[model samples]
Target: MKLFADYHTHTIYSHGTGTIMDNVNAAKKKGLKEIAITDHGLRHFTYGVKREKLKRMREEIDEINENNKDFKVLLGLECNIISSDGQIDLDDEAMKYMDIVLLGYHMMVRLKGVPSYVHIYGRHYLSKISKSMAEETRQSNTDIMINAIKKYKVNIITHPGARISMDTGRLAEAAAKTGTALEINSKSNIMTVDYLKVAAGHGAKFVINSDAHKPEDVGNFRNAIKLAEMAGLTSHQIINAVKS
Candidate 1:
């Protein structure tokens, strides 16, 4: 299989080291047909994209698209799930500027309120220490993710099993219903072949991404490709892959 587009990439707009143009140039060099500028959402405590700069980013992307007819760049946000009730960090006004949406569970986000904090962060950490809490937390995490999938038009769920435990089988069922693809993130090692198999069994589509934080890594998919192969994934099951 071969990937034609990378839908999860970062730039100076978030915590990435390169500028948007730099990443675009790198993707072009790597022979990618398209790439998305999916910076972290505004709720990320340390690296979220600035709300005031959304218009500027849109203008820059428009200019690039006008000048480069052979390649495409999508403007998107890797939004955070800020609440257990499926609330994300994106509003309708902000959604207007996005071409795609990628949601994920991340630590250090400004959550909705105290209840969200206790359910999302507090219980997550507690599960690591208590075996009993682990199963319950895993169920809660999966349910919350399912709620998000049902509530939004999420194109992809980035690194589903990374940084937190989730019931891959259950989450995949929900994702399949909403046509949301699961990301195989090359930069993170949390997703395993077993998890992929379970998700695939539920008919969940997938996407392999470098989760590139630098321009040079824009289209790197070696690790993700290996995992997908091990899981017996075909191009037809991957949103960005094609027969090679």
Candidate 2:
């Protein structure tokens, strides 16, 4: 299997070390056909892209697309799941500027309300300490993620089992139904081989991404590719890959 695109990449708009152009250049250098400039959403406390800058980022990407006929750059946001009810940090206004949407569970997001805080964050941490809460939290997390997939036009779920614990089979079932690909992130080891196998068994599609924070790291899918291979995933099951 060979990947043709790197859908989950970061830029200076968020916590990344490179500009959008820098990442684009890096992807090109790595011989990738396409890349997405997926910065953090507006709610990430430390690294979220400023809402006002969305327009500017859109313009930048447009110009790049105009100049390069052989390559594609998609403007997307690595949006946060802000509430237990599956409300993400993205809105219709933000959606206008996006070519794709990538949602994931991340810590330190400005959530919907206190209720969301208690349900999404409080319980998550509490589960770490209490064995009884672990199963409940895992179920709740899976339910919340499935809700989000049903609620939004999410193209991908970045690193499903990364920041929190979730039932991979359950989440994958919902993702397959909704046509949302689960990410195999190269930057983190959260998506284990076991998780990949479980998710794939539910007929869910996948994407291998660098999750690159630096320009030079763009299109670096080695780790993710190895894990996917270990899980016996073929190109047909991966959105960005092709049979070689």
Q: What is the TM-score of each predicted model, taking all chains together?
A: 0.98, 0.98
User: Candidate 2 on 1-244: residue-level lDDT in tens?
Assistant: 6888999999889999999999999999999999999999899999999999999999999999999999999999999998889999999999999999999989989999899999989999999999999999999999999999999999999988878888888999999999999999998888778888888888999999999999999999999999999999999999999765
Candidate 1 residue lDDT tens string, 14-42:
99999989999999999999999999999
Name the runs in model 1 displaced over 4 angstroms: none
| Candidate 1 accuracy as TM-score | 0.98
- Candidate 2 has its poorest 10 consecutive residues by lDDT at 159-168
Give me the displacement of residue 190 in model 2, in angstroms: 1.4
Give the whole-model CA lDDT for all candidates, comma-separated.
Answer: 0.94, 0.93
Q: Residue 123 in candidate 1 has what lDDT?
A: 95
Model 2: how far residue 63 lies from native, Å? 0.2
Best by lDDT: 1
Candidate 1 achieves a global lDDT of: 0.94
